[model samples]
Target chain A: MAVLPNAGADALLMTPTPLADWLVVAPAVLPLLVGAFLIIVRKRLHWQAPVAITTLALVSLASIALLARVWSEGTLVMTMGRWLPPFGISFTVDLLGALFAVANSLIALGCAISASRRVIRSSRRYGYFAFLVLTAAGVNGTFTTGDIFNMYVWFEVFLISSFGLLVVGSTRAQLDGTMKYGVLNLIGTTLFLIATGLLYGIVGTLNMADIMRKLPLIEAAPLMTLATLYLLAFGMKAAAFPVHAWLPASYHTPENATSAYFGGVLTKVGVYALFRVLVMMFPVQLLELQTVVAWVAGSTMMLGALGALAQNDLRRMVGFQVILGVGVMMAGLAIGSAPGLAGGIFYALHSMVAISAAYLLVGVIERRSGSASLNALGGLWKDVPLLGAIAFVLVLSLGGLPPGSGLWPKVMLVQAALEAGRGWLTAAVLVSSLLSVIALGRFFLLTFWRPSSTESRSKHDGTPRVLGVLTVVAIVMGLYPEPFVAAAVRASDGLLDPAAYINAVFGEQG
Target chain B: MKTLIFRTVAPYLTALMLLFSVFILLRGHNEPGGGFIGGLIAASAFAIYGIAFGVPATRRAMWFHPIAIAGTGLLIAALSGLTGLFSGTPLLTGVWTKSPIIGFDISNVIIFDIGVYLVVAGAVSSIALALESTEDNH
Candidate 1:
């Protein structure tokens, strides 16, 4: 391995070996390569599904390996183009990032499986699989990149591919949905770019680790303005309060598989960016803003849950729950303690699986009954007992019930808030949980328990098999949360102390 | 629906614009004119032809789906990054190979630029064509 001596030299600095760092790049690159390949053979409809599934499976395997490597090695950093840290693009993955990437890959795999048949039959003209893989690549890049500007680039990549996916079939409803989704998201990304420009102007660097090192030397006033700008930009992306109107209006109208993918993976990337930038980069600098964030967190939870309670459409109801999940994660960040950070990480992992599974199950029901409206849906329990049982578990987990994945994270958050002496946040979490129970429970009874007007058997599909696997994962994680809890604690430690991350990226000079 | 002026000038204009696009793409490594601008320029040429001669003629001229071109371009860009991996450098690290006989420098950067050029051209053209076809149907 050739080590370039000069810090900002243009010479290529080779690592000891390339294969050692392959996992860091593989998760992002594999999907991109696969997507390009799928596009080349677009006319061969028979090859699309198998190729997509295989590619996603490989990506998932790579993501898991990356997580394992990060778990053992602490933060892993790789600089692109062999340039030094502040001058070139770099990707650094901590345990939190690795965990999120793994979850993202799994959710994408689930969506791919769910879309296999539908894409082949109805979406042959739209290049559905290519956009799906491109979205995965974008999400992976967002999770793993260590540069702020690079994160913005990945956000655009995600947004563009998602725009394609949103209106692939070009139905009237889908086109309307795409218009709202596209315009609002474009506004959000533009804000994000503006915030990036401001941050660069202030710090003169966009490398995240470098910015963390330089931020403290700068004045606090301008930094607060940047923080507010970030909150607004990422808030729109996460669909947080005051700017969450686009999510429910558009998310419910996409195809079931696409909806499931967006529900599980898309907003979480925004939340991930928020957690990464706000909590990790400016923990001490943003103390005054944390209180405002706490209020926003509480309102987000309350409003999202309340909105869910008012919806009769199943996908729309779950769309609000996605907002609720974002609020829960925000509460963890607001508390700003190690325990709170851990709780947030845990809840993010839990919700990614549970939310997507819930959407997939609803998609199956919709496929069978030809409607996702709760008022028109009934007696599904008798029609498909297996799906009913899976839906019950998913709904329970979503509502934060005991013996479910959601409950553990809520408990952790409540305890953290109590320890941090944030009694209002504790109250917010409990109240939101109560509201969620009412909302999801009402959905449960309406969709499954009540007698139906017709008793015909619904058509079966592959959604259940994929969703069933996800349900088992959620159940297992709930029953034995020791490993996941430990990982969350470790990830929170990384977030709370940026020194390890800084040193890894900048070497001893940091 | 043909415009006499556009139809008379379209073929020569398209050929010149495409040549200019390649020149821009080649100079992109060291100059401001790169794949994105080059691709857009080429797509404009196609748009002119489409408007003058209609979509069917434009489609015939393309001879391949613009989306496929975009996808192929993406693959080329991604594969160019792998050259760095094979040379034991970080991803997307430019590996230069100077040719003795030609006294010229070659690098993966140029390959990546070409990839970017194709992707931009393909994406823009596909969107333009789709809109035009839909309008034709209506």
Candidate 2:
């Protein structure tokens, strides 16, 4: 309960009483079990769409409650079966898990709702729903799992489900996308498995808490060796620079709704896992190995923006730009200082919402206009004021313009980089943001600013509900980032102190 | 003549293999076999069935595509883990209380194993079926 009272859990264990700690666990998992049941049962029900939608709405509610609990309290951990630390599997809730679960699930529900009516139009719609839930479940598992091996397993669960979703329709393009997605990620998975095995061999335990506790005692060489493998694996998953071939290869393959879900949740899992393992378990090297990370992140951000600029396809351009955001966010972690980590965390939450909104707008734009290619598309700003407004908000936020949530994170990261005396990072952020603006703005201007040509596909407006969902998220998050900021700070605190995590697993800090 | 006989029994054999896969999943936590191996075994059975009966029949018998089954399996396994999160236990925490009833042994953590069983079985067979279909098309 509340990080085991920050004392010896032995004192806390004598009571075995329920607290807010138990509350956090329910939200992380409850709706998934219920959702699965509802989905399957809905198969037999007459009104399957409503049933599935309502179930996800319930899940969204559960995540909101959890975020509230985690925000009010710092972090929550539950030891299974009344067992003390070091003996039983522990499930933990920190700011990172809480924020991601709430925001991602909400966005997930929005994405699901946006496409629910149309999904069943496909014969494989049930499979798609199943994949969606599995993907969400895998992401939840990835964020909440406290064991290192379990995290690897969860990543596979997410990846495999995503692979299926990518090839849901099995067209030639889908196969090409799935092949790229599956092979690159498979390599990442292989490295992760080998690294996990090596870490387990060195540490004698796979539980993250056990490892974090024992890390201070072990030889550093093996740790660093495994860390490099892990960083590469996770970096590839996050689509950081050169290793990001798979992302652009497949990010545009799936239907827009599917792409929206991927945009909203999948890559963010890589980001969350990187933060969880690198920050939570490997603080010593995180500080020492900061340079390699910072440079990699800087390069990833710049390259991603450049890649986006080269794309003429709306979805592909957004996909490339999403990679740039990954580097910027990870750079915050590379800083390893408090402000930097918080900035990174804040940036992650901000980008997930901003990117999801952008993807949703793109989908609706294409749905109404009949093509997502910039070369074949022309302005709808004249005809569709609503889409234009959504585009304005999304682009402004993506470019990290002021008065948007993006600006706050960029500001925080700049400060963190400056504090770390990597003054070049401040300049890097400026240059990267400037490039991102140009990259993003050019697409927007060409698509929305200019008038539609004679052969242009007619622009269709997004449903009120779809536009309403993302608009509310963008506005609320942009206007009030305090809650998100607080969650990030708490999550940062939870990660920095390995004592609670270590004690929960090993029964003692020593 | 021999090939005809193998073809004739293959469909039934697929059923038997799936049942055996269930056996492995049930016994896995206490023994050497579990979902992954069991699922693979079941998949191979389907592959054998696919060879005998053709890809379409095999997929038709299974009811969904190979990838869909894998996706569903993953979803089920993940859901089983999520059960702990909702119940106020830790995520992925296996919760079971063993009770001895003169001759009966049952713990619903066994149900969790069944979910894993389905996942593994579904994933392996579907992959087998999908590969078969791709080959057939060529």
Candidate 3:
């Protein structure tokens, strides 16, 4: 049944008891429950793969249902502990949250499928699936949560789980990378906590909806400070510009499955938080800090492309590509217009799938060639036509070319930048895409099209089906982007004008 | 570091601390003590026992992998939150009741607290035992 009627409907028709409120919490809760269960049966290898895949599939289905519900019902709200909105924790599922949650779970589902085939038995015994599910729980929780401090709690959840996932193989390089990843991420987490605390102090509330309502009422100076603190904290977490060093250093250290998952879904959480907090809650402060964001976004784009170009290892190159996607999204954020935010949201949705597909494709190529070094790898096209085809699509997608998912978002962002009269951002968007094409196109040309330099490794029977699914989705979005673009535009509307969200939380409660 | 007097006193000290930890967990809802502190105390008890009697001995006494115990605790805590569903309330809402046998008030909150206790005790003891075992290896 529908939760509520459309917006501007009569308040009297709002039911005190929402029948489907449990749906709001399911995306976060189910994975956590299954993750803990997986830990209990960590010794049993047979149960882990099937159980994790089924749980993620269920989560994806539930998130899709939530997206549908929020699409029709405007915004869905559920408060924990039976308390009112101001005192209780709220799970508000607006269009943006639902969109991201769906994308997050779908990407995770893809990674889980690849991991079941790729991750060895020993790592599975050491709670690999458990860490993956827990990280999913954290990502979904961050996407759905309506409270700022609650968002911080979710950050710590995934940070710890990602640490576990990162160190699964326990190799020396993995340890080193995990250490770099851990210390820097912990610093970012601490900054998030501190910023959250200060925001709570000044506003006396942690709910995002409430903060949005109260922000304009408070003094501007403290709000701007809080905004800067959040920008730094989330910016670092998102791996923007100067603080992006840890990503390329560590993302390649883990198993390819882990790297695919991280590349696909993890950092997007920080971007989502930035959109929710700065764009939604403190619009004025975002406007004030716009120039800083544009600079960070522009430099991150150039450096990320350059870094990708300089990489010898495929995984590290993908890591820099991940950073490049972050820059593109940040460019949209820097524009701070309706279409700009829409562009950011669209790019994030695309990156979540495209980047993971890229990582998985690289994993497959490395498995086939027994090497990830671009200089040593060649001739996948002659060796395996299917693998070459997947790589071609991925290269196009990551390069923001016409035939894949990346094109529309870049178009939206560039158009938005042009409309907003931000020539630098427009140039950044175009230049970044051009450099990305050079880097990724070079990768495709060298690894797939060129003649072989070494003998192939022991060939596996088949790749996971999810890679095809992601590639198809990217192509569909690129070719026919009407629905995705419409959803993004609606999501940006919800973000810019949060009255429906605020109402869903404050207006309807037991 | 395992002195004769310390080893001799450790058993009784561990017992007392375990009992006190339960007491603290039970009184948590109405008083200052709760699962977190109580679990810390219990874990401290295990650490002390491990120091005196050795890691394998402590593991033998527990009869379960510390991580498994932690996982079980997490499951219990998450299930306890579902208790609200039966009463037509939101997830994690405390559902109180009068215990006919015990002649006292109880709730899912207490069950959740016990889950928290097991999680804390299991996780911390695992960490403590790991450190001790690694030290012995050295």
Which residue pairs collide, candidate 3?
none
What digit string (tens of lDDT, one per residue) describes model 3 on residues A6-82?
Answer: 33422222234455778899999999999989999999998998999999999999999999999998898788876
lDDT of 2 by residue, A172-288 (tens): 998999999999999988998998998888888877877877778876456777777888888888888779888888988886777877876777777887888888878877776
lDDT per residue as tens, model 3, B14-98: 9999999999999998999999899999999999999999999999988899899889988989999886555556777766766
Ranking by TM-score: 3, 1, 2
Candidates 2 and 3 compared: the better one by lDDT is 3
Sort every candidate by DockQ, greatest first. Answer: 1, 3, 2
Superpose all Cα atoms of candidate 3 onto the true structure and report the RMSD in Å to 1 decimal. 3.8
Worst lDDT window (10 residues) for model 1 chain A?
Answer: A1-10
**Interface RMSD (Cα, Å) for model 3:** 8.0
Model 2's CAPRI class is: acceptable
Two-chain DockQ for each candidate model:
0.57, 0.23, 0.49
Residue-level lDDT tens digits of model 1 in B2-81: 66887899889988999999888878778789888999998887877787778888889998889888999999999998
Model 1, TM vs. native: 0.96
TM-score of each: 0.96, 0.87, 0.96
The superposed Cα distance between candidate 2 and the true structure at residue A410, in angstroms, equals 0.5
The deviation in Å at residue B11 for candidate 2 is: 7.8
Which ranges in model 2 have alpha carbons more than 4 Å from their true place?
Answer: A1-28, A31-48, A80-84, A123-126, A455-464, A503-510, B1-31, B34-102, B130-138
True lDDT of residue A222, candidate 2: 68
Q: Candidate 3: which stretches are off by over 4 Å?
A: A1-16, A508-510
